[model samples]
Target: MQLQTIVPIKPLGNPINYKAKIVNIGSCFAVNMAQRLQYYQFQNTINPLGILFHPEAISRLLEFVVNDKVFTQEDVFQHNEIWSCFDAHSDLNQLEQEDIIEQLNSKICRFKANVFDATHIILTFGTAWVYRNKQSNQIVANCHKVPQNQFEKELLAVETCLENLKKIEQNLRQINPNIQIIYTISPVRHIKDGFVENQRSKAHLIAALHEYLEKNKPLNYYFPSYELLMDELRDYRFFGKDLIHPNDLAVDYIWQKFVETCIHSNEIPTMKMVDEVQKGLVHRSFNPYSDAHQQFLDKLAQKIDVLLEQYPFMNFR
Candidate 1:
């Protein structure tokens, strides 16, 4: 008897290889994929503006980057003795207004440069629920622990999200025509938004993503990450303590699926070698100066040298 239901996913037409430059934005789950890419020494840039959870937040950043818009002093606010901008996550919050403004603008410049050469751009949307700042009548990426009364909570309409996403895609393509775009709904559950509301949020995101992908068929792909988690790994054991986030095992399983579908077949051997090297680097030896351990180190060093000689950009460490 079959044990578990599997989600069918087709391999990407243009798979990402070592030569491909990749940029990932949106959602903390993007970090999971970016971390794997970093581990295997793939050319990857992730979330320059930080972990933005909604499409509005992501589109806002992309719009600013494409237009070369700079955040002025008025765009920032002082809250809890920290200077920060609502357009970016709390991670970018700084102590000085000048520091935050410079950081945001610098990140936008870096994003422009990165996307210009990116071979693949991956966007992960976490939620459709958004918070609109009452003061400026604008949606904010993160509230940064501000009082709940200061913002109006809202669910983004499918039409609004679809338009924003299209704008983002158009802006990105203008800067880099050859770049392939991938979209996925984050599997992380927003339980705090209430279970039914969370489902509603995901429904909107899924609808918008499918509509976008259908219209822009070429060079656009959608990986059913949300389906994979909800259908394939339906057990609560796959989630962390809060039962909202994917655990390490679940993340690894998703990453394996991601590689299976998105990575070039030719890169498998090199990935294996890299995995071996990574494992060796982290392996612990009981004897620090034994001849056998020394020989092992020498062999590991040789393996690293061989890989690095061909792919000079890859760093074993």
Candidate 2:
């Protein structure tokens, strides 16, 4: 007897292959998919500026890239001896003003180039809740651990989120008209936002996203990542220690589903070969100098060489 109800996924017409250049952005869950793609040796980029949880933060990033905006000292601030930009995650924060500005500009330049060349763009929206800086009256991507009183916490309305989604689409289409956009709601629970409030936040995001997808069907698709976790893997066992994020097993399950629907079937063999090489590369023999170990290393090298012969971009080093 079937124990779990599977989330039905429709295959994409233009499925991703080894040659596809993929850009993954948005919440932390985006990194999970990107990591899987990277392990398979696919061309992929993820959150160059940093993980952005909401649509407004994501839209602002795209706008900055499209407009070729340069980051200056005015765009960043100093707090607790760390220089951080309101537009970027704390991972990009630096100890000095010039360093942070340079880092932001560098990321923007790289991300802009990636967008122009991207064949597929995957966006994972995490929440509708956002924090706006009281002084600037602007929604900040991250507060950078500033004083709580400095920002006004707010939940974005469906209409406002929809506008940001449309803007994101417009900016992406402007850069590359043929790029396919795949959208998904992140499965990670924002328990800090309160259980009921978290559900409301997700409701607003889903409503707005569905509206946007309904209006722009061509070259746009929605993946049921949120449904997969909440409906199919509906158990606390799928969650991590914090009980908020999906554990590795859950991520792998969702990734397999993604592969079945989104990835080109022809790339499976190549992906398997890549996985073999990856596993062999990390293998350690007790006797490093043994003839058997040397032979194993030689065989691994040969496998790498064969793969590189066809896909020169597939670097095992």
lDDT at 223, model 2:
93
Candidate 2 residue-wise lDDT, 1-317, digit = tens:
99999888989878999889999999999999999999999999999889999999999999999999999879999999999999999999899999999999999999999999999999999999999999999999998889989999999999999999989999999999999999999999999999999999999999999988888999999999999999999999999999999999999999999999999999999999999999999998999999999999999999899999988888777
lDDT of 1: 0.93
Show where candidate 1 strays beyond 4 Å.
Answer: none
Regions more than 4 Å wrong, model 2: none
Local distance difference test, candidate 2: 0.95
Question: What would the per-residue lDDT of candidate 1 be over residues 1-317, giving only the tens digit for each residue?
Answer: 98789999988899999999999998999998899999998999999879999999999888888899888898899999999888888899999999999998899999999999899999999999999999889999999999999999999999998998898899889899889998999999998999999999999999998998889989999988899999998999999998899999999999999999999989999999999999999999999799999999999999999999989999875
As a whole number from 0 to 100, the lDDT of residue 23 in candidate 1 is 98
- In candidate 1 the C-alpha lDDT for residue 142 amounts to 94
Collision pairs in model 1 = none
lDDT (CA) for every model shown? 0.93, 0.95
